[model samples]
Each structure stands twice: as C-alpha cells, then as structure tokens.
Target: MKISYHSPHEPNCSICKKQCRFYDSLREHLIGPLPKAECAKQFSERGCSLCLKVFPTAQQLNNHRAACQSLPPLPAISGLRPSLVNKRNQAEKEQILEESSNKSNISGIAMDCEMVGGGRDGSLDLCARVCLVDEEEKVIFHCYVRPPIPITDYRYDVSGIKPEHLMGGMPLKQVQEKIQQILYNGEAIWRIRLKGGKAKVLVGHDLDHDLQCLGLEYPTHLIRDTAKYIPLLKSNKTSNSLNYLTQSFLGYKIQNGTHDPYEDCVAAMRIYKKMRNEDHSLSATEFVPENGVYSRMRQKELEKMSPEALLQISQSDFYCWCMDSR
Candidate 1:
C-alpha cells in the first residue's frame, strides 16, 4: 500500500530518482502499471527485490543479496525496546568506517539540536538540547540547554525533553560558544570562512533550522546538509526526513521513540560518509567551472539533456558531498 501523507521524506526511486509516496509506490513506478521506461528497464536488470536497491552489475547484485539475506534484520530505532541494533550496526560499520578514517584527512562533524517551544502559545523554537558526533560516531558533545526563556512546551512528544533535563542544562551562550569553538577547530571563524583553515565540515539534516535555533552560524561551503543533497532528495525534489533517509541508506530505523540527538547525528554522518565513499564516474574536469552555463541554457535544452549532461554543467550550484573526497 502507498503511504498517504505525501511525507516530505517520500521515498525516491533508486534507479530513476522518481518520487513516490512509499516503497510500494516506488516499486510500482519501477515495475508496476505505467512504469517509467528507462527506470523500469534498469530496475528489472539489477534491482534487489528485498531492499529495492539497484546494483551496478549482476555479479554484485548476487553477492549483495547473499550477504543481505544473512545479515541481521535492520533495527527499528523507534521501538522503545532498548535494543542494540543501532549500536551493533555501528560497531559493524567501524571496520568499514575505519578504512576511510585511517586514510582520510577530512574533518567531518555531524550535529543535531532538539528544540523546545517558548513564548506565547509555545510557537517560538528554543534550543533545548544538542549533540555532536565525530566520523567515528563518538559523542564529542551532548548537553541539555538552558534556554534564556522558560520552555513553555518541551515538545516531549517528540523531543522527550523534561524539566528535570534542563535543571542543570548548559546555558545557551556557553553551548553556542562550545559548538562554534569545536567547529572552528582552533582557527578563527574568519580564517576558516575564507578557506584559509581546515574547519570541520558540519553535517546534519536540515541544518538551517538547527543552526537558527541555536543562534549560530557557519560558512555555507563548509556545511553538508544531507536533507538538501540532490541525490538523497525525493523524486519530487523535497527533503526526506532523517528517519526515512537513515533506514533507506543506513539499513536501520531511527527517531522511532524518544528522539535521540545522537542517533540523528550518527545518521547524517553515516549518510555523508556513504555518499562520499561511492565510486562516481564523473571527473571534476568534465564539469563546467560554474553554474552559469546551466542558467543560460533554454528550458527545452535543459529538458533534453540527460542527468549526466546536466550534472556536467552544474558544478557550482550542487557542490555535492562526493566532491569532498578530492
């Protein structure tokens, strides 16, 4: 059955990038009535029946399925059962993650913030808690925030925040200072912004909102927003929720119960790493120097271009995470 909400996190077809309300809808788009011709053809050749992921070749698909079948079921983070699936998966990935960490010079820091409602009718967002994790998914910082104004609504239904948690929470000013200091990684903010220093790349889903709630700012070029990444977006080009993106890409479900900032941080970091690790075929040299060439093209010309062609001309605007590997 197709999902009805048309959630912002709508699942996108792995092959053609068409947006669908759910996996079932994606399956329909791939192999159902009135299927997309190119996508359907590609899906039929290499798509995984279980996870709907399309592999690059028949041999890889067979190998992936054999391993996929024997793997433990993906743990649902939404369950309040206090299971170890997320942890176990993280532990398993450490071996893989270490391969990258052992050699890479990148400084990627993933963070997430929980907001509580303030002001009249509790409409204003106040930073209630925040968590930051390194590439290793190790918690570098995790603290409940003491908002300037009392939290009128803890948003506990989602945030799981309570008065007790804020009783000794870190002050907002201090939290901001700490986060900025960590992100700046000892360099002055100005130095990092001018590309003169090795500022940590901040990774998160919907970072704009989180940064706003925390009253902090960072250089846009140094930020990696998983929500805004073109490839991770819904076929309709909307941002997918962290929950959907995590389960789809990370092989686990999260944000299922009491929201854990750590879970979200880890999810965004894992997705960033996953995308970074892909063997993209395009060379940076093939791409146009900037995005201006794309805007100059007529609509029909744009429409006629293939995805690869458009990508070749969209170097400036996209600034995709994969390019960071360079």
Candidate 2:
C-alpha cells in the first residue's frame, strides 16, 4: 500500500483546483471580494452552498442542496455560550416555557437523550434522561427517567446522571405515553399512522437509537435523524458526531462539560429548522416523477432536458427537510 504525505486538512478549490487551508478559505476564493472570475461565475451558477462543491449542472446543484444543511445565519458559535440557567433567570426560563407550551400546532420538535448503562458489563444503553424542544428552542418536554433495569454504570462523566436524580422520576411506560400524547396532539394513533394526522416531526441525532431505547414507534417519514442525514456526513460518508457537526456547521461548542440533553435538543432543532427554512419555491416545472421512473430516461434525452426539467426528473436519495416547506 502507498501512503500519501500531503496535508489532508487542506482542500482544493472545486472549480480552479487551487489549494486552500480550509473549506472556508476555498469558499472565499470562489465567492470573496477578490474571487477568481471564472470560478466565481461558474460557482454562482452551480455551486452547492453548504459543501462549496461545484456540480456539473444547475439541476445537480439544486438536487445536492436538497440533501445539504442550509446556511447558518446565527452569530458565530464560539462567542456564544450555552445559556446556562441560574437561580436569578429560572423564572424567566419558566415563563418562556409557559409561553411556548401555549402554542398548539407545533409542526416540528427535536429530542435528545442521555443514557446510563445496564447489564453485567454495563454496556447496554438505558435512557436515563430525555429532552424535547420546539422550533423556538423552548423546552416542550424534559424528564429524568427511571429505567426498568437497575443502573449499573452511571457514566457520570458524559451523562451526569446520578442515582438520586432518578429517585422520583417518571417510570418508562408513563414517560412513553406522555411523549406520544404530545407528539400526536389529540389525534388517535391510527390517524397519525394511516390518515396522515398532523403528527409533529421528530428531529434528533441518531434518533433510531433514541426511539429504540424509548420503545416508541413513529413513521420513518416523520423522523429526521441528523446522524443519517446525507450532507451532514463526512466526505467518506461516515456519520459525524453531534459535537463535531455543531462546531463545524453551527459555529459553536456543545457537550462542553457534563452532557445536557436540553442543549443537545436545541442544537439539533436549530440544524433542522435551518435546513427546513430554505426558500425552495416550487414551480409547476419543478416536480419529480415517482421513484424508479426518471432513471429510464436515456442519456441523450437527459442532455436535451432544461435545468428545471432535469430537476423535475431528478430524485433525492433521502427525503430532504426542504420538502417540509411543502
């Protein structure tokens, strides 16, 4: 096997192939004040806003953006703190929660869980705490859970879960029922499953594991797992940790000391809302046929199609949050 010696951190410009210290620098090279003229123009026509990669056609770029996280408009993530609540501000936080709770018809919510360990080796993940937040990053539900099995490993360093915390906590079964009520609103489970009830979209990082630990079932269509999101993955197509994704994209630090499910919940919600907030106005010309239909188009036929027509025919591998706009 051959080993390469170049610095892997430095990436090349997608259009000019110029070396840059970082992806941001490469992006600046194409779009900054002193940008390369040809690359700038080409990028403007077909560049992916999130990845900064140039695609072959505008339609391809549009398809790529569908799977990517939308641009972050918030202030720099570093200068920002996690908004730790102190005794003085506790009332304010409670007031905010009360205000948030009054708003019905919440279309989306993000959840995060902290786990303690069970089993002989203390390797089994047992949900010890859960937090859910609405689009406003207001706490909708937060609880420490009493696991069915006895706690073997507290994992206090990461989870901050202590025995006394679960002393008066809600039982797992009760917790599950409460969550379903909030998610489904007043609709019956069958209405949500079969009749397309307005069940709130669940957003989280590695949500499959969270949902499994909770022993809850939601339609896959309504769950947005950030870990499984295509654009949030590494270049090698591996999952990025929530901390890494938060810092890299959202421009801040999280999971700083002890893990707070509320903080994680807010971060995940911000990412989802940002991605879903894109103004992807769909025209009559912008519609893709049903699955397995577009691939039948011949190469020559695809070449002759207009960019909008090509977009109309193209399909995304994952259901993009942008579709939530519809």
Lowest summed lDDT over 10 consecutive residues: which window, candidate 1? 1-10
Off by over 4 Å in 2: 1-102, 281-291, 294-301, 305-313
lDDT of each: 0.70, 0.70
How far does residue 77 in candidate 2 sit from its true spot (Å)? 21
Error in Å for residue 21 of model 2: 21
Stretches off by above 4 angstroms in model 1 are: 1-33, 36-45, 49-59, 65-106, 283-317
Predicted candidate 2 versus true structure: per-residue lDDT over 1-326, tens digit per residue? 11112222234567766655344467568888899999999998988655577899888887876666433333222222223211226577456455544467578888888999999989999998887888876667676788999989999999987786777677899779767877777468998778877777889999999999999998898899889776566656678888876775566678877887877887888777766764443423323334434344454566686754544344434555777877
What is the Å distance of residue 2 in model 1 from its true position? 39
* Predicted model with the maximum TM-score: 1
What are the per-model C-alpha RMSD values against the true structure? 9.2, 9.9
